[model samples]
Target: MQKKYVTIASFTAALEPGILEETERYLAIIILLAGFKRYRSWRVPIAIYGSALLFGLSHLGNVGWNGETFEATIAQVIGVMGSGFLWAVLYLYSGKLWIPMIFHFLMDYLANLQSGWNSAGWQFNGWATDYISEVLMVLVPLIVTIWMMYGKRREVLEENADRLMNLPVEFNRY
Candidate 1:
């Protein structure tokens, strides 16, 4: 006897969560910006860091839900912040939410496939390389995000600050 598997179904199931997560996080950024409207110069920084930190903290609940180890969960939270920051910056830089949504979806989908949707109770074996990889995971995206938001690329966010923040007028003067 042979068994059939529905790979497309698994991929489709993975898609919804990524889109919803990114949408919610980005909306939170916009809301943060709106709330800080009076502090025009600090709005972008607050929105990006605030939303990204919230996104990372959200993963903490996964430790309880998925039985993930505390240490592993801590690493995941830190790593996810980098990813969240990168996504947020990508949205700002491209002036398109879909860019980050697609990246987020693809990343989640691939991870799901790699782990076969059975990531519960995963742990680090304490290899030196494991620690190095964990650090790199967090640092690389953070470095990239910082680079993307500075120098020439900063102009992109400045040009679309109003649109990205959902504000009525330009707020990037600061």
Candidate 2:
């Protein structure tokens, strides 16, 4: 989806500082104003849950090789799942999925960059060689996403014409 790509691209840029939760809320306001508030509905939970589930499943195959204990695997999976919810909220509140997307990208990218990531083969980043390059990649999308959704205007009628025209005056009795 275009939005998903954009989300990935935005987060890939890595421009945002740490205040991720606050950023998401601000972004949500923009989408609400832009009249895309419908995406803010169940979409948030769905996307997050889906992403987390997939992430956990991906780790399942690696359990034996990675030597993770059963308890550790469950806990890790749950943490990853929670990340999905957090990211969804971030996307919803910020009205800019870019940051979360880029953040997500960074997370995935870093994971791939680790020594064992390439062995997994299915999820590997050929272009992101170093931490610096990966970080820059993450930052680009974050900036662009924010810039695109920076500000929008609405034609708001400040005063009602009828109310202005209906002013009445009375003579005071002395």
Candidate that would win on lDDT: 1
Q: Report, for all candidates in order, the number of backbone clashes.
A: 0, 23
> Residue 128 CA error for candidate 1 (Å)?
2.0
lDDT of 2 by residue, 136-168 (tens): 443453344334322220000001111122313
Task: Compute the lDDT for candidate 1.
Answer: 0.72
* lDDT tens digits, residue span 1-174, model 1: 112223776577567757877898878888887898788667766777788888888877768546677887877777778888888888777878888889887876676676655323445667897689878877888788667656567666655667765556543346
Candidate 1 versus truth, CA RMSD in Å, comes to 3.5
lDDT scores in order: 0.72, 0.39
Q: What shift in Å separates residue 136 of candidate 1 from its native position after superposition?
A: 1.1
RMSD (Cα, Å) for all candidates, in order, is: 3.5, 16.3
Candidate 1, residue 29: lDDT: 81
